[model samples]
Target: MPADQLTDLLDPARWDPLPHPPAMEYPLPVRRRDPRTLPPAPATGSAPEVLSRGADGVLLRLRHRAPRARAVALHASGWWRPQPADALDLVPAGDGWWEIVLEAPADWRTSYGFVEHDGPGDPPWWEAGLKAPGAPVHPDALCAHRHGAARGGAERSVLSLPFDGLFRAGRDDAETPAEVHELPLGPDAPRVRWWVPEEAGPAPLPLLVVTDGAEHVEQLGTPERLRRGVEAGVLPPLVAVFVDAGEHRGDVLGVPGGQARWIPEDLVPRLRAAGLTAPGGRRLALTDDPARTIITGASYGGLTALFTAARAPGTIGIAIAQSVSLWRYPRGALVGPLREAAGYAPLRLRLHAGRFEGSMAADARALADALDGSGAEVTLDLHSGGHDWAWWQPALLHDLAAELGR
Candidate 1:
């Protein structure tokens, strides 16, 4: 049952909780663009304003005008689907302008757009208001930056709320260079990127395995952060291995044994042969003391990190999960077994979740409590943020310091 639980968790189809946005749902009802009914982009659009901040969330006011719209609504990535309750009715603010005010978490940063509808049955008119030329598509781009296809094959806008959390800035001046390695898991396997802190001296370095390797390296600045951490002595020198999920990320990182097999059977051997050390200059081994190995990730990646620690106890001594999807199906499959694994290997964990992530946040805390007497050391923290990179980027930095500083 325990082994099956791990395999069940690895089932990719079961992992993703949020469906792709409506815009991404292709073959959308086609309607001829009626110039009279088409919304003429918003004018004088800067960014939404933070009208007020309170205990619940932040109140935001966004102004635009769709002369033809009988109804308007706000849509964002986090919501499962754009609900009628999320609809924003345009109120005449004068001079052909209308405004809609919505409340969002203080740390919410995501792609969004204002959709206009002509009638009850009319198809939605997607409009990303006038963005400054080369301004990176504003007021609606889905994120500050996007990778792969924009959701829905339709361009939305970007909305980033103000956050004052402390995230150490990465250093670009470090002489250490990052390297990319290929893991031949077939032609479709995720690409690999790594950085070995030779600067940590002759001793073999510890290893930090990051899921979602490509984005963390390119978008989230993982390599730069590692470089900065080593040079600043904030974290001990370590070999950082980033795993890319490619198209099958859901199958690879989201599922339970997906990462377990790849890391131990595939990644570890490759790193060992490449002269990457697991403490004491020894080749990487699951049977090693385990304390020297760390696996970390956010969201589904976070979920996988915990499973990896349990599935390959001798290989991973520590797991750092950020905003993990504990609220998903087979919800407590991993947690339940971890609590009952009588001879489970000694492991340490650092968990970080967002106060705004609702149930997932609560689940993370509960997960930590569940592990209290299970022979694993655990720490859970709730930061004022959301499920996006804006929160995880800095949180990862802090998690590293906590683990490698030991």
Candidate 2:
């Protein structure tokens, strides 16, 4: 193609200004339509070998077939929204490949794509091969790894808690279940919130006490999916308690993650109080059925789930960690700790991450591998997306169905 025509192809208005590719390209159809509290993210890395990131840019080594394009210049649009700017680094070497890095400001989010160029602009301008199907066509939602397909065919939801402050725990009374009554904690109480499933038919519904309760509703689509899946038969009815993590999510969800107070005293007693009173009662208390119990969350919520599972063996049988914020904490590498934890106690886990969202996929894969090798039932889902609700929701729904539903 002539340079002029190629330039025409490279025109900003030439392509659809949507966040992602079209419907045919939409990998997770259900996710594309919902309104989430958390918006899309900016660019991370591209290429391989370097390392993708949850941070602004992702780094990778590219081995594209073209040798001349090795000296490729990079240009992007839709990242953070409304304009075009520099977003990638392409440095080629003798190995017939180049090292490419893609970046955007942390809060700058929206749809974006890259074009390959020669000098400042190339002769045969071509796509950088980084968009996905079913991605929004508007710049409002452009982001890398929007649907990295970290986990596919599963459904997910994101609920936003419009408030932030000291979290309060509340429960319902039998006479008047309408009111959400506040509960009490000891001297130094850990914030807690109680969950009453829409329909509770079985005894000892498995329990999952998630840290950063408010954030789960804010960042991840947990409540909606949990309710819908139970109603739709996709997942079994399980009791979930989102413990109020408040501002200390960093400290609480990390080393101790607030398990001492949250689990041993607060959680168990509450479930016992809510006791199995229906018909011929079974001894299956909410906190009793370990195998049926699963602790889940994303990011810090994710790390907390893993930490809780690691510390409390036979108590929390399942761990659902999505885009785990492992590097944030001391000894943040969760795999080694999990490996040791698994030795003392057995656990089943569903770990997943994508290439574009930091080193999530790689790190989680290593952890899953280690646990699986140690005789734990582990499923490793490496998707084509990043660290966003777009991928997390579907990944958890599908992977959990395989690991826990059956």
Candidate 3:
């Protein structure tokens, strides 16, 4: 696509309502439930149902039943401050069913919801409370699977395809789970959740520091995934620290701030004081070497991961930034400084982004290109899907294994 065309694609204003594609384009399999029998046979069946699978991709049918609704729209993650015009409006099926068929990759997963407009005129765009005069977004009542709760305490519906991966599934019955502990740094600082291997040998282990700790723990099940990787020999036994930012996430992780420095300056020193850095102190020990220390996060946290590593390469050597918000800064603003810093200490970076994330995806590619051969070992992995945790959780596991398994 041309640059102009790509810009238009990214612009939500250009996204008009769409109708379901022709049957020939997305041929429904005979074994699958037909669109006419929708709301599923049992009536309580979960959605968005998989209509068909083909060489191209899978066809997903997302539906909502609102008998008196004037309009309905679909809202997915990564769309910030979404307006009704920015969303995909669903067409009326029959009775009161409104639905849209989407084509997605086999491994795609995302959190989505439906907006029902009942009032006169245009529906209001979503606000913090979703209390705008016109419409409010609601999770798919028919879909049992749900993602994390948003600002208004409303959970979004999850649409996930079959994925054959170590991290997506829960731990096996026989595998020993990683021991989780809480570390309080001070009243002013956020608490940290630590995960130590159950059978950590008496040797210094690699460390992974994750930002946006609470969400990764509660929503993504990251610690368990890490535990699974270690037991399966896909990753080395290690210590992982999840740093909770709480309400101060934007102040700390969004930019270069004092609280952001706590990870390298205060947190590491405190962990050492607890005898986590050397062997023979307890069940598990962590490496003091920055080369074995990896820091990772997504979105704004992702931007912070790169910033933290660049600022303190001696404390953090590897950075795995997933779906980074490089656009938060001016275009290429971070590239020059990052390149200069890497030229001095040389950092290893793994940049991951989704091809569906518009300019964010382009920015990741641009950052990778700008950092090339600048004394930094940089690798960029572009995956299918959007900025939802559905992709970030599994991608983080793969990154950890790739970086630490060797």
Candidate 4:
């Protein structure tokens, strides 16, 4: 398509915006739910408990008294990476109470939840309880240190191991309210949210476009991270545009055709119209310079971030793709072709995936290596965690600071 036609195709007022595409399939680690029927565990209580171990370890004990559960397993961040293990399995005790004691690093701060399997041929139940088809399950509500809802519809229990001054521990130091706007991408297109630093100067700010806007804000605490980074002098002032995934997130983020074009061509203009980049506005300067703009996301959104940068070369300077879906099983696979492509735009990139992400981690490394061969300044980090928010939150802060910090 001609560049002019591509730009016209994304004119939200003239277009209904493309419908979200189908979901991509990737190999997520199979969780191990022991099929043995064990006696009920002792009834300790309903609330979560944490105790300090010797200097570096923290003991985490959880109790659940589900009578029909054959085995109760705990799912925390970084626990189920690489392969399935019985370490998180709660030991059966007493008549109905089941418990699992985990000795974790003292610096751990992540969310968790329980899965109760009813033996073979039965599905497991999450802490969100039972719900009708298509209903949302709030995972944060189930946690002992519940903050708010998380991404992907469900929530998890939070665990902040005893640590002082850890980067991602506890609540955000401050909060900034965001302005929400509906773009004309499609009738069903999700609304995007805009956020500026609470205390920015008159200078024009760089633009940071985040895919999966709602999840990043409500679940992963993106605004708070931005706030903390700015307050700590780790990041420059930037205007953030958060795009929502809606029900068709899989289609929207998984495919590059629609979302890739819509963001820079369509949504960005809308931002400008809102006086975000106007001379006397919030001063979000839209530019063709790659260093002044960043696009970021996780999982399928991560894949979209890379696709967006690749598709809109001069438009997006930095791409932060966290836990990108690089596998082939899903609809949008980029590594193979990206490796073979002769030329690419001069885009600085940061790629992150959990070390426990199994094949996905390998894919991230492969993509980074290919980018390196292509002479792209790419930073690939395989952190010590799973494809969970526990890892993505910290990765976002680190990437933003590394890419745009002054």
Best by lDDT: 3
Give the alpha carbon lDDT tens digit for every residue of 177-265 in model 3.
44578775678888788887667887888888999887766655678788778878898888889988787666677465434467876
lDDT of 1 at 226: 71
- By TM-score, who's the top model here? 3
- TM-scores for all candidates: the values are 0.63, 0.52, 0.76, 0.69
Task: Determine which window of 10 residues in candidate 3 has minimal summed lDDT.
Answer: 23-32
Question: Candidate 2 on 212-290: residue-level lDDT in tens?
Answer: 5654443343555565566677666666666765655555554443552256335655665665333344333564666
Candidate achieving higher TM-score, 1 or 2 = 1
**Candidate 3 local lDDT, residue 214:** 79
Q: lDDT for every model?
A: 0.59, 0.46, 0.69, 0.60
Candidate 1 accuracy as TM-score: 0.63
lDDT of 4 by residue, 94-176 (tens): 57667765565555555566666765743332322222111222233224444333444565655655332223622442444
**Model 2 regions more than 4 Å off:** 1-187, 218-221, 257-261, 264-287, 329-336
lDDT of 1 by residue, 1-406 (tens): 3544544444455444444223222111111122223344345445566667787577677666567666555544444222243244445556655666656766666545555555665333332211111122223321233322232234444455644223432212333445444444466446776665545565657778888876766544567667667777787777788888676666676555577567865677666556544345644322234688888888779978876776666667788888887655454666654553324567788888875454667788778877777777888877654455645666677777876677
